[model samples]
Target: MSAVTPLLAAEELSFAYGPGQPVLREVSLAVAPGESLGLVGESGAGKTSLLRLLLGLSAPTGGRVVFEGHALDRRSAATMRKFRQAVQPVYQDPFSSLDPRMTVGESIAEPLRSLRVTGDRAARAARVAELLTAVDLPADAATRYPDAFSGGQRQRIAIARALAPKPRLILADEPLSALDTSVRMHVIELFQRLAREQGIGMLLVSHDLTIVSALCGRMAVLESGRIVEEGPTGQLLTEPQHPYTRRLLASVPRLPG
Candidate 1:
């Protein structure tokens, strides 16, 4: 564990669809300030369920989600609002994540308006432009709608929107999965730069170990709702102790040396 206080943490988090249908079991993980952590698992391994719980979209059957030092209180609007501002989310599908009806500028600025950020229209506009630039999008692109851009560009716009609130942490759920292979590395580089230069932490959830290795310093392998192994990304890739983790590593394609 990092010596610095964790920005977000799940303590013994467990969830279930019904009395006997448990989706998660005693899951614990932490993302420290400016740290990038990855959660790796197969389909139906409860990764999305855990994310929903962390995002406060769903209440956990057991355990709790903690931010900074305080336990999350879904009942408290103030707490949730503050949490929302500090921790933003970048979901997998950029095509569906963005609103086709809204202009790109409006979409990016929505958080500032909804979060009640203390800024007038001009200030907000400037912030939006700044974010667009940060994500390598042209200032003029903001005038267009989501459909005007390609998949990669749309993902950049989604990233810009996530940055509008100046979040301390970003929860990325399979952020690169929907992109073409040609663009995946670009997005990965963008994520690396954002975390390095902006001091933003991240919790990246993906089934692809290759993507996880590229972006995360540490990783946890989930199997059947349990974290079977975890460690530094390099160590986990080179010397996975669990059978599930080894199998996962073996599944990754490698080119001839």
Candidate 2:
């Protein structure tokens, strides 16, 4: 565990859709400042539900999420606003996450405008340009629509938007799942750079161990809506103690030599 306060944490968390259909149970995890924690699991394992709870998008039926030593209070406007400014999310589908009617610049600036981040119009526009450049997008990308770019480029734009707020933590839900194999590598590199150079913490949820391993130092495996195992990425992946963790590792695809 990190000595410093965690950026985000879920304590004894649980959730369900309808009666007798639980999605998560007693799940707990944390992302420390400048750290990356990968949550991995098979489909229907409740990874997304856990993520939603962590993000304060949905209230937990059992436990609570804590951010920066305070319990999340979605009902309090002040608390929610501060939380929104601190945590940014990168959804799996870049196409759907972005507005079709808005230009890329407008999309990136939306958080700044809505969050009331300190800046005049020109300052925000300059920040948008900086973010685009950081994400390896050209300045002209701001004027283009989402359809004007490839899937990889769109995800980069989404990343740029997420970084625009200078968030303390990033909640990424299968960010690379929607991209091609060739593109996933570059996107993963971008995430690593955020952790390494930018000093940002991330809660990256993915089913692929290899992808997460490339970026996260710690990892937790979810099975049947519960955390079955967790530890350093290399140790846990190489010597998985839980049967489910072992099974997940065995499922990863390898290249033909």
Candidate 3:
């Protein structure tokens, strides 16, 4: 079998703002088809900055982002359009991520409109219903507004929206942080199921080690914009090498011996 090209990759990426010190220095990572990677770090570790660079929201001062073997060239509208179509993002705050005025169905279908997907009104509505069902939301939920649902339900809507584009890869930033602790695991499970069933790759960014360990097979630990350690989730959690990585693992509470 031929080697499967990576869905997304950041090669020796470096980014900085103004004249300040670089936020990300020589950082690199890759997300392959059907792969899920967890990006973990404390605040100010430059995780967000790195995500933006990967998403092509901002160009890096050095290095490059490659998607599907092609270097991202925002200068070309075609490159950007194709990149946007292939990559989707799910933000942490579902409520804010969703438009208040647009109905849930409209919000989910917005991507279809942006991508100029072909379909009549009825067909689009049917697609919206299908997506809602996929996320375990009732079809009628689509007629309601974002405020009509609980935090968890709103997040489900967000995930449905991310899935709308039929993206090759999903970049989720702190997806469960804004959710209730009880609902976090449920959402994480939903992510895993959706990614697996859809055969889509995921880059999940979060500080919760337990959640990452549960949801992702592989993980990368970031400290001050650099990847300090990376490996299979199980090995990294049990036997981390870097002091920063060990400290992160230490923060996770454990049962009495």
Candidate 4:
């Protein structure tokens, strides 16, 4: 873990809307190669805002975002395109993230077409099927429209779309929060498998400590846009230093004795 370089990094990131309401201030974190770093916090703790800033979708008020040791900017069009392809984001609301007008297959293929990845439509369709199978979904799913799928299925489709570009870094913002327990377990397992097998670095933004503990090697707890505590998952869960961390953990339901 100490040997590899970071796949994604942010230094002293600050962002805000209008003149007031600063969402993030000096928030810094790094995700190592092929590693999973969970970002957990209560709602409005600036989790989603930070992700947008990292992806270059929203400019930081005052800080830099670096990916694969390269600062993210449009200085070179080709370089910026490569950075876009390298980093992909999966939003929490699949229903909204996906284009309702497009079929499942079309939605998945959009990335390849937009990126000009240089592949025939037939070949891309075939690859999409393979990805669906990898995610434990049916091939026929690609033929259906997004409206036909359930919440879990929609999330699966969204994940498949993100994987189409073969991104090195994936930022999943609460990808499994909407699903039932059974479906959430399946999605979490899929995420873990992808991290291990595909060598993909994932920045999973979630408020669920149990989910983070299951998937992330290390994590940071955010409070009012500040990382109050951060360490190995096991260490922090067993013995957290910050009061907010302990309070967050206590909020999770526990079984009877």
Candidate 5:
């Protein structure tokens, strides 16, 4: 199956750290070619757990996870490597994601190096600089350290690093949650641009429904480990059918009358 196909799927997925302590309760979701789905919920509502399951990081305690229409088993050396190559994840904190000791340039280019991109060091550095520009950062950013950049700028660096692999799907966990409120909106917009322009399907796990509603075409609201409401973001937000979803929608701060 191709990455452009209904590339990733999870059916009735449930997981937990211990017996009788499920974190995800039969959470079913999918990401087809060029699609973005936002999963939103309060802390401990299994948002992060669900993201991990979708990315084939943790084995699903129940149900199955299918990538490129193939069910995953940890031991399949070839299949596991293929899955890893096709699916990449962007963490919430850029500073922590990068090795402080490594220069920003090195951090972004490491994936290519690991993949054995038979090129001279100069070629790799050029590629890294190109990616940095793609995320709206300066080429000089390649020489600087993550500590030298602001929170928003560091996230752009993280995004550049995530894009280095040219993966089909990116699982972003609260990617913009760490930035200041003023800078959060810009990062969210950058994600929207990447999803549409790159056709990079994203499983965005976040608690900010406002951001989800703005960037996502569809969203699932998790409550008590289950998806309480899901549909087109516009419809769900305006006319949520589930009580929990309604509560979530109502809780979003509204502008003054």
Candidate 6:
């Protein structure tokens, strides 16, 4: 671990649906301020379960999630409100993540209102426009509904919404999985630029090693809800020590040279 305190961390975290059905066990990892960490695993590997735990959407059965050195206390509305402001989530499936009835601007400004950010209606509108530009969406697009946008555009809108709070950390769960292959790289670049320019920490959970390789400096390989391996992204990809990690890397499609 870095000497600097983590922006978010899962320590010996575990989860389950019932007595015999374990979803995750003994998982531990951290994302430092302005750093990006990737959690890669196959479906049913408990990746989403872990994300839920980190987001405080679900309580873990064992251990705890720490944010800036303090354990998360969901019952404390004041504390959780602060936590929500600092940490935001961008989920999978941009198609369903957004509300069809609300205009793009309203959706983006929702966080600002819900978080009680210090901004009036006009300020929020300006912030929304700024965010739309940051995400490469036209400012005028804000008046349109989700149905007017393509899958990639919707995802960009989702990203803008996540950024509205000026969050310190972003918990992105398979953020690019729903995009077209041709546009995936563009979104990947967008994520990289946002992380670099805004100094925001990210915990990206995905099944795609390629996406993780593109955005994450450090990565943790999760298998069956456990962290099988973790290290610098380059090192883990080139010299995977765990069989599961190696298998995952091997599965990535490569161009014949």
Q: In model 2, what lDDT does residue 27 have? A: 92
**Where's the lowest-lDDT run of ten residues in candidate 5?**
111-120
Q: For residues 17-67, write the lDDT of model 1, one tens digit per residue.
A: 998999999999988888889999999999989998999999988899999
**Per-residue lDDT over 191-257 for candidate 4, one digit per residue giving the tens place of the 0 to 100 score:** 8899888999889999998899988999988888888888898999999999999999899999999
Per-residue CA lDDT of candidate 6, range 1-257, in tens? 74899889999999999999999998999899998999999999999999999999999999999988999999999889899999999999999999999999999999999989846999999999999999899989989999999999999999999899899999999999888998898898899899888988899999988888899999999999899999999999999999999899888888999
Q: What is the lDDT of candidate 6?
A: 0.93
Task: Write down the TM-score for model 4.
Answer: 0.95
Q: How much is 126 displaced in model 5, in angstroms?
A: 2.3
- Candidate 1: stretches off by over 4 Å: none
lDDT of 1 at 205: 94
TM-score of each candidate?
Answer: 0.97, 0.97, 0.96, 0.95, 0.93, 0.97
State in Å the error of residue 139, model 3: 0.6
* Top-down lDDT ranking: 6, 1, 2, 3, 4, 5
Compared with the true structure, all predictions reach lDDT values of: 0.92, 0.90, 0.90, 0.87, 0.84, 0.93
In angstroms, the error of model 5 at 3 is 14
| Model 5: residue 38 alpha-carbon error in angstroms | 0.7
Clashing pairs in 1: none
Q: Could you tell me how far off, in angstroms, the CA of residue 71 lies in candidate 5 after the best superposition?
A: 0.9
> How displaced is residue 256 in candidate 6, in Å?
2.7
Between prediction 4 and prediction 5, which has the larger lDDT? 4
Candidate 3: list runs displaced more than 4 Å.
1-3
